[model samples]
Target: MYHSGRLGIMDDGQSTVLHDSPLSQFADQTAEFLRYHVLSAVKLLEFRRIDWELVGRLGQVDRLQQLLGEKFRLVLDCDAPQYYELALEFHSTFQYIHIFNMTLPQFAMATGFYTQQEVAKPVFVSLLRGVMKKQQDHCVMKEDLARFWVTIATSPFSNNMVASDIRDPLYRFVHKILAATLIGRHEDDNKVNHHSLFCLMCMVEGRPANLASIFAWSMTRPKKGGGKSRMFGGPYITWLADNLGVFVDYPVDRMHTGPALSLMELKSFQQAGIITCDTPPAWSSIVEGPQVQPPPGSAADAAMQAAIPS
Candidate 1:
């Protein structure tokens, strides 16, 4: 009866065999066994080396996301080095899919992953500090650092996070870069400093007051007398002045007419106690010899004489 509709004596014997076999119950039990084994397999891989092929196949069966989600949660909860080791592996393996296929924020939402704030802001800051410290050892690549900076700056959760969360550590990192730039270690050191400054600006978005203070402090730091040369600080100050319109409502090309126009604007602010500028203009040499007459009634012109040191 199971195979053919034959109702002969042989068929009756086959039907009796089928009835006694409990095939339906056996099929259900086998399915249950496979499900258990698959879940076990995924769990085992979490603590050991991941088999991507197997994981991919399991994903095809709609288990990869759940398994990886569990692993990610474990990573957030555990401080054990093993968890990090496995987490790093998973991140590297699936970063393309995780980053491009769906943004990290979206992935976090879909998978119920914790935001950095939920993971603890201090912990996140500490991790950033650790990475920055390691960069001093030449262990981190500029590109990797840039990517990390961009992600933090653009990510929804991170973009809105309080600046105080990472302010001290970020200031420390900028100070380190300043020290390196002062030392003039390599030809590309200025570029590195510039890139670092840019990243810092990005990280401080939405807080113009804080950003202004940071730029003021950076530009005004006392320089050692009789130094060979300083490439980073002076140029950075000028860059900030030149790009002031980008962050504030100040006119763009309005301050670029005179040779020392930008410097005068900064000096006016410095005198007004709005900003400070201890370091002289980097382009002083080029702007010397002639005090280009400032435009009539120009505030920058009026401040120009007081701005320049004798």
Candidate 2:
């Protein structure tokens, strides 16, 4: 005979017992309910025809908020795909309020979604920090980084107090990416440079002083050969060459002076596409490769003959 305990346990004669704590049982029940009802509610709310007034009257929004609050940890920490889906759905459906209401730390954890939406200063800072830290991870996806940059460029975070607050981190991030590109460790160097340049441009927009510093930094970097070259080959360098007008006229005389290439030389190189190089081209080839002549009446002749016949 089996003996049952108050804690929902059964002892089958031996000391070995099967037990389920009431708390654990309650948690399991709660998870099941969320999996069914909460997830369904999110799905229903995602549809276009669903009336928001009706949804509010039905208390679906309140129910979702309650369920999400209860299962926040479970949904975020779980490795299951469905749990992630639920989190994303809840986030997208209630983005306006939920994103703004969450604390910075909480926003950081859900940056993958927050970054895709409009973000305020605190949320932007949190997302930027999250992306920077995530980029350091070995398994971070390029798409995630790309999305982060896109968000930064398109959002209103730039040209405001938020930009001033996050400027140091932004500069550090750009410097790290530039260093990687110079070392040739980055696989898609061109793409990385393009995104990085856009980010910097947005950051320095309406601020010529910041633009001057970035311009000087690019021009002052060591060249491929011995002395400093104005037209060094890199993504950032290329961007500077194209946007030379923005930083050219900035009065940097009062500011700290360094071993930067002169504005005249930069403009010359930009206009003439000429670089001061000591070495000549090595192993130059013709613009077009040697052409090959086809065999007289080869496959073409055979196909024509076959088409004319059977």
Candidate 3:
């Protein structure tokens, strides 16, 4: 029923719809395929290294027998507790970067991105643009990584709807999804995505790119059956407080800049369009009383717990 429609390849079992069209043939080189595969792998390997760099260092994992059994495609048997556990461990442990880089690039190479001299340059340019766009969409838009960190470190998380404590469950839930989402996917939004670079150009007296916020709201997660809540301890925060402060002098005491800026100071900054705080009820007003006692662990402890799930 289906035919390759080219030099003589055909498959009888496939539907007539399986016939490859010229669009299908020519579309393989674009970023859609690469973005899908890459982001899927990124989700699988959240907090892990990107694949393009790894392919040069190691061989790919191709043998399915180890994870899937002799049948290779059989559904996992619930009775097989050991294999079930193995499957969980496998999915949790596997970093899928290599699979993406190797497979997608192979498609691009076939389309002459890596071969034909004339088309290769444009293909490479397009590929770079796609990657840059994606990276911009995922990360916080600031003048630099430093500002990105500061914004996240000070963002509100918990309010009366969730808990009084700054380190509330809703906050963690939101950030966990956010960190993972940004870690996995990229998109093309020339506005906020391009902020840090544009600011950099401005610093050096170069022509700045048009920049805007990535979204109407700050980085936060929605509540169940309701509104959204902010998150803390984002990558930008950690990087800014620890690494970026050496240059910016943002006064990151108490592990973040929150302590440095009083409620009045924050309001003034917001009015000046220098920084935007999450809308009220402000973090202070959310709590009924004084601050909660520190949990069994400190912020450092929470970071470790996040790294390896129980």
- RMSD, each candidate, Å? 29.7, 29.5, 25.2
Which digits, one per residue and each the tens of the lDDT, describe model 3 over residues 41-108? Answer: 11111121112122222222222123222211111111111111111112222222334433433333
What is the lDDT of every predicted structure here?
0.28, 0.27, 0.24
Worst 10 residues of 3 by lDDT: 72-81
Per-residue CA lDDT of model 2 for 1-310, tens digit only, reads 2112112111233221112211111233343333323222221111011122433533444533332232221222222111212222222233222235655334333432223243444334422221122355212234443433433333233222122122222232332333232222122222334234433333322111122222223332222211221122123322322233422543222111111221122222212222222243111111232232222343433444567755
Clashing pairs in 2: none
All candidates' TM-scores?
A: 0.18, 0.17, 0.17
Clashes of each: 0, 0, 3
**Top candidate when judged by lDDT against the true structure:** 1
Ordered list by TM-score, greatest first: 1, 3, 2
Q: Write the per-residue lDDT of candidate 1 for residues 166-238, one digit (tens) a residue.
A: 2232232222333332212222321334334433432332111122222222333222212232222222223
Local error of candidate 1 at residue 186 (angstroms): 18
